[model samples]
Target: MTHSTDSNQTLFERAKALIPGGVNSPVRAFRAVGGTPRFIQRAQGAYMWDANGRRYIDYIGSWGPMILGHGHPAVLEAVQKAALEGFSFGAPTEREVELAEEIIRHVPSMEMIRLVSSGTEAGMSAIRLARGATGRAKIIKFNGCYHGHADSLLVKAGSGLATFGHATSAGVPPEVVQHTLVLEYNDVAQLEEAFALHGKDVACVIMEPIAGNMNFVRAGVPFMRRARELCTQHGALLVIDEVMTGFRVALGGAQSLYAQQIPGFRPDLTVLGKVIGGGMPLAAFGGPRAIMEQLAPLGPVYQAGTLSGNPVATACGLATLREIARPGFYEALAARTRALTDGLTGAAQAAGVDFCADSEGGMFGFFLLPRLPQNYPEVLTTDGARFNRLFHGLLDGGVYIAPALYEAGFVSAAHSAQDVADTVALAREVFGKL
Candidate 1:
């Protein structure tokens, strides 16, 4: 099939004229891979068909929310049933309570949660609550860890250690991020030193337990332990941003995995999105009653959303969570993810291509290097030209991965053994050319 045919090209041309970069999300423009973005007409289990009637095995999984793949039966039914009842009440609903209870039940750290329309809102609210509860104005975030597009968090590390973060985006003022300290991922010593210098003023240390934006890197065990210990010692809240890994990594989330290694491990606050929404616009942040109670009506920190918990969104999220909670769901998904990564690595080796990959559950990332990158700087050393060739090659062979190298890829429960084999075969073909 000719992917760049008029069918998709025409739509993209129209879109670019109307929408910025011809896409709502920056990566969807395919600017990194250098191609016209596919205009998806429809999607099914593990597959998406573009406007040109070309089908590809979908590995992006809508970034992370489609863990059960597009059009899950249970989720679809629940959403439809909810739409019949109402769309948004702009008030409370029994379904909202049920959804909150479900999330709180799975993650013990969240004694209470407030739902929002997107991950950015959830993250921003969490930070505000942290500062208000602790009466501190500063926060520490890792370089590659993405909490959301919130202005204060949209920052990069400055030239020297202990320096305040600088705004990465154009519109964000430098003063906004003056109190935000950006550090390197998995650097225990650097983290400790930062805490030593500014611990008293810091309200929270926010991080993605498994960093997904820099393509699936994890904090070392020692680093994780030290951060938790220092946060407790400094009276700073440890906020785990699990928007991507929440239910996609495991049933209990990435926090549960950490609890296994660290005794009594739990974040003072947690940020959640993606899979919890099950492909809808829903996200949340919560913690023990004390900190959460700081948000409006109960205390000084104020946050509110007009459509906080839409009936349809709650129904979709609730149904998706219930399905994934079934016994052995994650085990099967993890096996499929492992098969994909291991197969691709083996094929790359046979083709004499320098490559490495890593995975947790359904989320995974690969790099064109001899060893996996441990931090943002190392992740940038990838061969961009070679990766572009591989990306287009796989795309032409009917496989869809993320358009950018720094973005993580996802596998879904809808994927089968045959799907894994086909993806590996396609990668081997692409590696041969590289």
Candidate 2:
């Protein structure tokens, strides 16, 4: 089948003229996949209609916010009701407090919380709070664990351990990242050595408990436990950036999952986004009272947002949370997700393809290799050309996943057994071709 470039091409051309790379985000440009970006018109349930009226079974789930699926009745109703009340007041609202309380009730680690407009703001604020509370300068982060696009967090490590990270993006001065330490994911030895060298100067160690940016790599239990121990021993805070995993991995987020594995394991600060906003631009950072009180109006550190605690966003988030908290919500979602992944892996094996797939709750990823990767460098060894071919093949077959292979795929509660089976059948056909 020859794919036609009609409306989507025209839209991309027009968008490129207006917006940089024809996208607000870099990955949306389809630079890695080499295709014209699809201009989505509308989405309902698990499907999206592109500019040309082409329909697809969306697996991205709006990059992880639409857990209850696109246009869920409850979420829409709450959003519509909130919209009728007002859009933004730039003042306090009762719903914001309610949302905060709901989050705190679910995630016990959050004793005090503050709302923000984006994940970047939440992550940046968490780092600042850590620095202020500890009076330390340096911070540690892991590779492939993206903490938004903050300047300090953008640094990539140099050749050796104990060396400072260099900025990965332009416009970030070298001096800004001098105190930023970037270590390898799942590398407990490196993590220990870094603390040994600069534990006293380190303010916090920020990481994604379950890294979805590098296609759903998880932090090893020992690595996480050691990180928590080292941070505690050094008087540095352990900040878990749950921007992607928050409310998606489980009811209480990745922190809850980690706590089960390592008893009494909770980060000093947690950064949240994605599902928490229910597709709106909302995020938050929270921790214990002692650390949270360092923020201004209560203490010394200063951080504020005009749109912080937005009412409509809060209403949407609250409704989504309530829906997810329903009995058997996660269990059903996980079962369906497992079915999909297992079917896909089995199909690939039957076709004599080298594939490794893993799923947790509603999120999953697969590599065109036999063994699952544990870190960014290992994940980079995936066959990009094969993935691009399979991606386009799946697009031709009516299933939509993230255009980039490095990003994880999501399944919503709306996905049925039929959706999983159909997706697996499509994958079988695609793998056969490969």
Please name the candidate that would achieve the greatest lDDT relative to the true structure: 1
Clashes of 1: 0
Each candidate's TM vs. the true structure? 0.97, 0.96
**Whole-model alpha-carbon lDDT for candidate 1:** 0.90
Tell me model 2's lDDT, rounded to 2 decimals. 0.88
Candidate 2 lDDT for residue 261: 94
Query: What is the number of backbone collisions in each predicted candidate, taken in the order shown?
Result: 0, 0
Clashing pairs in 1: none
Instruction: Put down candidate 1 lDDT per residue, 123-185, tens digits, no spaces.
Output: 999999999999999999998777878889887521111011233767888899999999999
lDDT of 2 at 214: 78
Query: Which lDDT value does model 2 have at 41?
Result: 87
Candidate 2 clash figure, as a count: 0
